[model samples]
Target: MSMKDDLNKLNETVKQYRDELRVQMHLAQQDVRDEWDDLDEYWDKFRQKLDDIRHDADGVGQDTRETAYNLGEELKAGYERIRKRLK
Candidate 1:
């Protein structure tokens, strides 16, 4: 597939993961939120990494988008676990 098609697929996959993350965040306990705040700086750094990686394919390199998307999935999984604990 072309780079544009690959990018489109990546975008859609990331969107789904992002949506799940939002759901998990919504269901997460206040205590969990507080705990997350303890690592707020870490998350901020991660966000910066992601931001830097997101750009035209040439500017960022081939794996940049994929790596960011994988990080997003990992974050979502963490949020999902916290949400489950809140249940």
Candidate 2:
């Protein structure tokens, strides 16, 4: 085949892969959105915990602080997972 014909064939293959990947990427995004929605409660609780701690830092017990810290860490990890999925 001529150089032009070979280039055309390669271009077609790339286009096919690009189209397939586009669909897969869209599905991946939906999965990520679902994961985020699942984390919504955790996010809300984490925010509320922080607000409580800020409002009553002096009155907050050690266990309460620890619980808030653990929840924050969990949220961070969950967000990191979503980030990696997007990548």
TM-score of each: 0.47, 0.64
Can you write out model 2's per-residue Cα lDDT over 13-82, one digit (the tens) per residue? 4335334444545557677667767666776776676667668878877776666666666666666676
lDDT agreement with native, every candidate: 0.56, 0.60
User: How good is model 2 by TM-score?
Assistant: 0.64
lDDT of 1: 0.56
Lowest-sum lDDT 10-residue window in model 2: 2-11
Candidate 1 on 1-87: residue-level lDDT in tens? Answer: 864465456555545544555566666678877755643444454465455754444587656666555655555565555546756
Pick the lDDT winner: 2
- Cα lDDT for residue 57, model 2? 71
Question: What is the lDDT for 27 in model 1?
Answer: 64
State the lDDT at 62 in candidate 1. Answer: 57
